[model samples]
Each structure stands twice: as structure tokens, then as C-alpha cells.
Target: MSTYDFAVIGAGISGASVAFELQAEARVVLIEAESQPGYHSTGRSAALYTPNFGPPIVRRVNAVGRAFFEAPPDGFAEAPLLSPRGALTLFKSGNEGELAAFLTNGTERDPIHPIPVAEALRLAPLIRPEMVAAAAFEPGVTDMDVAAIHQGFLRGFRRRGGDIRRAQPVTALRRDGATWRVTAGGEEISVATVVNAAGAWGDAVARLAGARPVGLVPKRRTALVIDGPADLDLHGMPLVEFAGDAPYLKPDGGRVMASLADETPVEPQDIQPDDLDVATLVEWLETHTKTSVRKAPRTWAGLRSFVADANPVVGFDPELTGFFWLIGQGGYGIMMAPTLARIAAALATGGNVPADAAAAGVNAADLSPTRFRF
Candidate 1:
């Protein structure tokens, strides 16, 4: 039986970040079920960073994560992970109340601004003139270099003496005194600590360790790629979003990618696109934009796992002595990865959690897995 100081299950951004952070201090092994790393939702993210995208807590995480994208560590990446890209939120007529609420909620960091109809179209040429009533723009949005960032983490982790094992899914786990005996790839691997960063399969991992589920739910989200005009110049284009997040569009190479923002509850598995979802997204785009998308070039789907309260589950499990919960990141995992990894690493290594995080009400008990028992 091989022994490791820490065994991180899941090689997505969350697990990768955690393994990398713990490499210098512990002998860590990163296990991924897929043939390749990030074969699931991590590689299929929207690939953009917007500070004002989600709720207040998510926004705070994004704010702290922006630092890593702005300046990555040496030898991790050659170029910056963030590129300038704006975002425009569109509101239909007679929905002045939602617009006011959005503006009020987004003006905290001065990143969101109310823009007139003409200005909205000027920023994103795809917006229809008559359909647009009013809009808000945030020039601070940036296109996230997800591939580079993932590679950076992998490179750093491996260089720091961390091992990454792909296609080694943990099938059974049990606590043996102070260590865990994990069975994966027909072998028994023992570890003093286990980090449950298994994304959609978080609950299953916990169950393997005889721990209770944390109510983590995996929701399906679909995306479709439509062909754009042959001579389309997508430069200076902002991510155009409909009010209440009904549907949205973003530039993808020479094509345009659109989504219905559907959140269908699903099990943890390899997800595929729904044809009806693609058709609905195209129809929605036709109603909001002038671009006539008859059919899409490609369509795909992935799961964005979340808990009952929609907050990320970090820190250790109160019930399981050596088990850590780093799941339920939802759609904001990529944007908040840096901060989340740092906090998880700190808690795992018995280091002091940041004062800012504590000030933001990041109590250990609050993120414990037992919170769901009550």
C-alpha cells in the first residue's frame, strides 16, 4: 500500500489549486477520473471574469481572485490570463424595477454603469435597436484564459513534487484510525487527509468516506455555437446578457456562442447538449439580437454543481475528522479559484485563514459539512 500525506480527488481547477498549494508542505497525489484533466466542467466554462456577475459573496471572491489573473507566478504562465472584454446587461421595456435593483446592487465597486440604448448597441453591435429599452455596462469584464491558468496550476503542482494520476477514480474509502484507506485503480492508497474536490460527485465521495451528503445538486447548463458573418469583427464586443439572465451571447473565435441559461437538475455524469435547448436558445437570440441564427455549428452541455444555499462549500467537514469539503463552487469556480484554493489550503495545513476572509464572515463552522444536519 502506497501512502501519501494528502490525496486530492478531482483534478479540476479546485482540486488542482488545492494540490498545488499543498505540494510544498505535503506529499500530495491528485486523482482524476477522466482520461484527461478538466474533461468535465472546468474546461467547458464560459471563460470570462466579471466582478459584478453573481451575488455579493461571489463578487467578493472574484475581486480577490482578480489578483492571480492579473499577475500569475513566475514560470506558471507566459502571458496574462485576463484580456479586456466588456459586459452589457439588457433590460426589456416595462422592467424598470429590475434595472434599478441591478444598478443598486452592482454599483458597490463602481464596475457597473447604466447605459442608454444607443450606447449599448455601440458596445455590442448584435443588440437589436427596438428590442433594447435600457442597459448596464461594465468595462471591467475580462476574457479569462482558462486553458493557460489550468496549465499553470498543473505545471506548478508537478514542479513542486505533486503527482497527478488520471483515470484513477476512487471507488471505496474508509477511515483507518487517523489515516484513510482509499481504493482506486485496483490499488489501496492510504492518506492522512482527503480533499473532496470532486465537483459534481462531491456527495458520492463523502458517502465513500461514510460521511453524510451536503445536499450538493448538479444542474445542467447548455451552450450552442452559431456561425457568424464571414467578415464579422468581434473586437470591442461585450458579453450581451438579457435581463434576469434569460439568455446571453458571447464571441467565440469567429462564431458566436449563446446559451439559454437553463438550470435543469441532473445526476453527475458526462453531459450532452439537448437539441430542444439549442433551438430555444436560437429563438431567444433572434428575439433579442439582429443576428439571424438559423442553426448552430456546435452544441454541448455541462453540470454546474451547487448546494441548497448556492454557496461554495469550503473548509473541513465537522463530522468527518480528516475529510475536507471543497465542493459546490457552482458556475463561479473559475472566477474565484485563486482565493478559494488559498483558503482551502490554509485550513487544511492548520495555517491562519486570512483576516479579510474572516471579516467577510468565513467561519469554520459556517462552511462545515454538518451545517446541513440542522
Candidate 2:
């Protein structure tokens, strides 16, 4: 059997980033089930980087990752990873309480401030003036070039002698004394450590390794793309989101991408957009904004896996030696990739948490898989 220092399952963004970070210091092999990497969640991301998006722990990771996205390492990418694209969260007249709570919770860490209705309309001309009572703006939000970043990691990993095996779905993982014997696509691989970056299939991978499941629930989120007017210029239009679990619209290449932000729980597998979700998104857009949507040219769905507490599961498994958990990123995987990859590399190589992570107030224990044990 071919042997390596580490075997990372799933060549999605999480696995790619971790493998890229570890390749220089250790012999790393990235295994993917699909014919191509990022066939699922990573490739279907909305590709927005808003610091105030997820839970507090997620926000902390995003904070640390921002520096890297702002200025990637030397020779990491051919073009910039992030470009400024502001975000506006609007509240209807009756939903003022929710708006207040959002501002109260987000203003401290995020660059979120109250914006007048006129200014909010100026930022996004598609919004209906009478529908909005109050709005908050985050000027630091940016449009992330996810493809470029993922490619950068893959290129760097290959350059550093990392091996990537596509079309190999891991079926079994057996412990052989101090190492792991992994069976995938009719091939066996021996590795000193195993990193479960399998995204939606994280629980299954852990089970294969004789490790306990962390209760990862994969939720389906759907998005639809609609055509825009030929003369309409979408430049400088901020991503517009309504208050109180409403639909959001983001500019996409002179078109608009709309979503209801649904988090419907589903089994781990390839997912498709529901007809009702598309209808709901269209209804919301018609009711809250001036944008018209007759039909969607394309609609798709992706799974955002999350544990019970909704924080990412990182660090080594408590009961399994040399088996690491790098799952439960939810919808923030791309935005938090750099910091999470750094943490995974540090833990796998017997090193401390990276100084940048600590400086950004990221406590490894908070993201550890051990928290779910008790």
C-alpha cells in the first residue's frame, strides 16, 4: 500500500486548503470521491465574504481569514481574491425589533452602521422605498473569487509534491496499530493520520474510522439566477437582504442571484433546488423590491453541514488517535478557509495554533471536536 503522513478525505475547499498548508511539511494525499474537486458545496457557494454573517465563532474565523484574503501569500494567486461589494440588511416597519437586535449584536465587531432609507435605496435601486423602515450597511463586505482561491490552493499543493486522487470514494478505514489503512476506489492507502474534510459526509467518514459521529446535519440551501435588463447597470450595487429571515439578492454578472436563505435539513447527497423555494424567492422579490422575475434560467442547491451547536468541528478526535475532525463549516467554509486550514495544519503537525489565529482571538478549544464528546 502507498503510505503517506496524512490522508485527507474530500478535495473540497476545506481539504484543499488543509492539504495545501500541510504539503510543505508532510507527505499529504488528497482523496476525492467525485471526478473533480469541489463538485458540491464549495463550487456552489454564493461567494460572498461578510464578516458579520454567521455565529460568533464563525465570525472570529472570518476575522482572521480576512487578512489572507486581502493579501494572499506570495505567488498564491494570479489575481486578487476579494473586491469591495457592500451589503445592506433592510427591516420592514414591523420588524424594527429584529433590526435593533442585529445591530446590537453585530456593531461591535463588524463594520455595521445604521443607514438612512434614502441611502439604502441609493445603494440598491431595486429596493421598494415604502417597504423599508430601517436598514443597516456593512461597507467592508466583499465579493470573493472562490474559484481563484480554490485553484490557488490546489496549485500550491501540487507544487509542494502533494498527491491528489480523484474518483476515489473512501469506503473503509481500519486502524493498523499506529496507522490507518484506508480503502478507496479499490485501492488501499496507509497513512499515519486521517483528516475528515468530507463536508456533508463527515459523519460517515468518522464512522468508517471507528470514531463517534458529531451529529452533523446537512441542510439544503437553494439559489436561482434570473436575467436582468439589457440597459441596467449593476455596478456598485450592494447585496440586498431583507429583515427577519427574508430573501436576499446579489448582483451576478449583470444578472441577479436570489435566495430565500432556506436551511432545510436533508440527507447527505447531491441536492437539487425545490420548485417551492424558487417560487418563494420570486414572491419575496416581487413583494419587497422593484425587481421582476418571470422565470429562472438556472437554479441549484448545495448542502451546508452543521453540528448541533453550529460551530466548525476541528482538532483531533477525542477517542481516535491521529484522526482529525475538519467538518461542520456550515455556510462559512470558503470565508473561513484560511484560518481553519491553519488550525488543522498546526494540530496535525504537533504544533501550536498559528500566531495570527491567536491574535484574532481564535481559541482552538472553542472549535475542537472534544466539545461534542460531553
Write down the TM-score for model 2.
0.96
Evaluated against the true structure, the overall lDDT of model 2 is 0.89
- Tally clashes: model 2: 0
What would the per-residue lDDT of candidate 1 be over residues 259-358, giving only the tens digit for each residue? Answer: 7788999999999988888888878877777678765458889889999878788877878888998999898999888878888888998876666666
What 10-residue stretch in candidate 1 is worst by lDDT?
A: 360-369
Q: Taking the tens digit of each residue's C-alpha lDDT, what string does model 2 give over 1-374? A: 89999999999999999999999899999999999897999999899998887888888889889889989988999899999898999888888677767776565656688889899988888778898888998888899999999999999999999999999999999999999999999999999999999999999999999999999999999898887555567767899887776578888988888877899999999999999987887788787767777655589999999999899999999899999999999989999998999988998898878988887788889889999888
List pairs with backbone clashes in candidate 2.
Answer: none
The best candidate in terms of TM-score: 2
Give the Å shift of residue 48 in candidate 2. Answer: 0.9
Error of 1 at 334 (Å): 0.5
